[model samples]
Target: MGFREGNLGALGHGIRHRTTITTCLLMAVFFVCYTNREFLRFPVEHELSTALDDHPPNTLKLSDVQGVSTVSGDHPANSLTLSDAQCTALFPHAFDEIELALSRGPVKRSLDKITNGHVRARIYNGALYLTDRGLDVWHRQSAILHQIHRAIVTAPSPSELPNINFEFSVNDHPSGDVWSLARSDADKQVHNTWLMPDFGFWSWPEPHIGSLDEVHDRIIKTEGSMTWEEKESKAVWRGTVKWNKGLRGKLLDVAWDRPWSDVQRLNWSSNALAMEDFCRYKYLIYTEGVTYSGRLRYFQMCRSIIITPELKWHQTTSPLIRSAGPDQNIVIVKDDWSDLAETIEYLEANPEHAERVANNTVRTFRDWYLRPAVETCYWRKLFRAWAHVTPPVGQLYPEERGTRWESFILMHRLHWGKNA
Candidate 1:
């Protein structure tokens, strides 16, 4: 009996000793990780290590922009010094859409279809001037103007910009050498319409969706607050059924009463989900509105799998989506959505693959392409590329252009009255 007690005591002592050693080792590991936290962070690819490498070596300082010296440090003009290479690195297919728009040839100004509703503008001596005030629809025209101003004011060589004229349309559909929000594949060849960044990049106050920068910060916080495992394991969507009854309506029918679906008709007056809240679901459904839905970019910011039909309308960053292969960041089902249920089931069964797709979405959109710096870089590139297609006609007259952007914003009481 005494021998048995002695053996048990020794065993207890050994366990205590091993436990102590294990605890110490774990503490040491935690200490090392905590001390080297910065090194352990996610490697940010957008770091400005070699920013502006492709820019002219003698790039002018930001102070060269008129009235920029008085701007606050947080102003966009005070930051975002990206170069062509840096922008291309962040968004590999950045110039694809631009090249497509200008592919036909030098823009024939006579072929341009301008109406009283379209704004006639020009860049003269690196300054934006508006000769005609197009009726602002949902503040789109004004928002576009602000974006142009931002691109010019924040550029490295604002003074050296080419003198070019452009007509901007606030309509959902436009043709000719006019700049617009989006263009369909069918009309892309039929018209010389150029796609600009959505007006929401500046702000969409009526819907209370705020600016792109604000949405960026909000989505980052929301996405980081939850884990993929904790998110609802269902495909989620919310949109008005009336917008595109064929597409959006079909989605509702497919998702109706399905245990794995959380689709609902949007009640904009009450139950509309905040853009950031959509991150709580495992999958997000994207659909095009009249043209391209601006919400796609916001959804791309989330760490959730994007499930959609083959997209008809292409946005500035739409080409980056890889629907197949190892790099597939989005799940593209048929237009009729007949396979949506099976796709959702497959994703639910394969959690790891779904998470990979979600991670890729965040990496492609939030971390790199849709970033503020990339957007500004795209706008500047647009200016340079547009100047190439829009050659000066007969004479170069800078004085004939209408009101300077600074004065136009102040004088325009309808849409830009807030700036005034």
Candidate 2:
């Protein structure tokens, strides 16, 4: 109902776009051995639970309806502008019963479309039963959910059927026939954060992005109060060194644990510290790990001026820092992370200017990046476009052959229950 009219291409926030870099994306296609469905459910660490428990006071709250109501999938809807949409004001406690049905593929449907990870699908009973080679948890949890949540929130009614329950992997990256489909399809950037916007943060714990507002608030309370001169002079970088093969190690070398630089090997994999713990510096540097770093979103929420190398990957937060723009929200460096020390000194020398840019960084985050409103708009647009192309759902696992669905049910019974 609140749909706004705008151009899709206008979605670019104007950060300087970079050409795709050669990375793991080019490596050999890895296939995941068939595993039990229980693998999809990851244990929620206590620290992660605590960190997310910190929610902002001002988050949007849906009122009026006592509980979720069923909505009709066949209900007609109009296109909306990206700016006019908002995050689902309310979501039901549970998602609809659906499965992402993937079909085997070797046929190249389109030559031009980025089909590396393309998964084809058709709309059936309000669900996008997808056919792909494989599924990855990182993409599904981070990038893919962005679309599903929008549909859940904006459905004609709560009762409207949900779509596409996934048999995604627990591994950091997934392989197999589904890789190409999961990565990209003819037009579905559905799972790529750079191409398709997401929360730009992790939604791993049940109740997506549960602790983000808290992270933002803590950063403000602890770091925002400090004057530029009062804070640590050097830029800070803290995270695990396991996944970020080249960049993470290269970064630590640059900092060399100098008197001013607070860089350390904090194993965020175990759990993240409180916001105050990370927000003590005037400058912060972000480096990618595995695929994309969710920590970048955490860094942006801080009062510190963010510095990092050119981003090889992107998420919902890409456009703001994408291309070097007039307002210095982020100081992007080379992949080698060259001149980090020099850059730190330049910002420290101009305390007033640095602080001003830091303020702009906050505004950029609050006003646009990952805000419920911006996310909502993009979500609506994705479904709106897909409606025109939805195909009829065909049975992915026929009775004559093996059915992964049975394995899914067994896994649910053996491991994860309704609570998970």
Candidate 3:
């Protein structure tokens, strides 16, 4: 009886041990599967076709919907389908206004010889419009127009549309995951705000100094103290300034003078000098002897110094300036203050170079860094930052699924407007 009881007790203990081992093995398998599932999922590709496929069927397509033909393809799960009329309504009117503005410039020149003041501009949507102005209009207007035109030209046409069916799994913890679709680099830059030409310069507040005398007073008040070495060190610390060779001596002599000739004599073309002045005197109430204030001022001064009427003459006459760039938008580098002074003085002395630089300078801000590009980049950066902080949450868990699509759409619209 004792032996039988001992055998039964040992059998029961063995059974309990086996059960515990099996439970642990099952738990390990489940953990491995869950971890692999999180990592093995496909990443979101930001291409147009991929975006259309991955997003919900009701995702908004911001394109001109006119003259589109849709045919059925191998239908995948969650494919987007819309009637011809439904697609047409997606085109934004703001896009049309922009395209009309850009077309006006080319149309005006073509119509200049004709009686019709109407300039026929071809839009990206294959639509045409008439405008009275040229491309040289206000920067803000021109920028908006350019963006609209770019979007129209670049966005894929209806015939080129791809299949919009895809599969998505519900995540147990959807809030921790993020998914977004963006255009290709080229397309993104074309449509996004960061690449807009006038990004940093537009809406720049005007400088605080009203006149050159105020600038001089500010400089003297700021740098009036210290030893000769300190002054030189301060000047060096200031970064770069465009002054004539041996002008340091001249500057020292006139440091206390209310209207220092050095201000007028200071070379504006030297980016180094301009940068130095900005760095040194940025916080000073007076002119730390910097030409303009801020980075925009530095850029403008560089442009002015490089493309002045005198510099243009050098391009035509002297071989030096002509050797700089293929597109004449080249920046010339100088070795020292003397070199800068000589370049500026030489250009000023030469009539041909002077005229070229003058013409080029006038055209630079108008043609290149206009307002539209600036506003776009500004808005885009803002949007991207916002998106990063508060990522979009899609329908996944029961809680998210319960929310209405309209609520999501409304939230996105509100975000865009607020950021704008």
Q: Cα lDDT of all candidates, in order?
A: 0.74, 0.46, 0.29
Per-residue lDDT over 1-420 for candidate 2, one digit per residue giving the tens place of the 0 to 100 score: 223323333333322232222233343222221132123222222322232345221232222112222244310111122111112222111001001211221211332322333333323344333333233343443344334445445554423332322222223233332221113232433332113343333243432334454565556667655776787776776677888868988888877866668777876554355545566678887887766666677677766788887765534345456224456788877877678777777877788878877767775664335444344444443443333233322444443222232343334222354665
Model 1 reaches what TM-score against the true structure? Answer: 0.77
- TM for every model, in the order presented, reads 0.77, 0.54, 0.26
Residue-wise lDDT of candidate 3 within 145-220, one digit each (tens)?
A: 3433333333334222221111111111111111111111232221221112221233222333322223333433
Q: What is the lDDT of residue 218 in candidate 3?
A: 44
lDDT of candidate 3?
Answer: 0.29
Off by over 4 Å in 1: 1-79, 110-113, 187-189, 393-398, 413-420
**Candidate ordering by lDDT (highest first):** 1, 2, 3
Q: When superposed on Cα atoms, how far off is each prediction in RMSD?
A: 23.5, 19.4, 24.6
lDDT of 1 by residue, 141-174 (tens): 7788898898888776787666788877777665
Where does candidate 3 stray beyond 4 Å?
1-206, 209-303, 307-323, 329-331, 377-420
Q: Which ten residues in a row have the lowest lDDT in candidate 2?
A: 92-101
Runs with alpha carbons beyond 4 Å of true place in candidate 2:
1-147, 155-202, 205-210, 267-272, 322-325, 388-420
Better of 1 and 2 by TM-score: 1
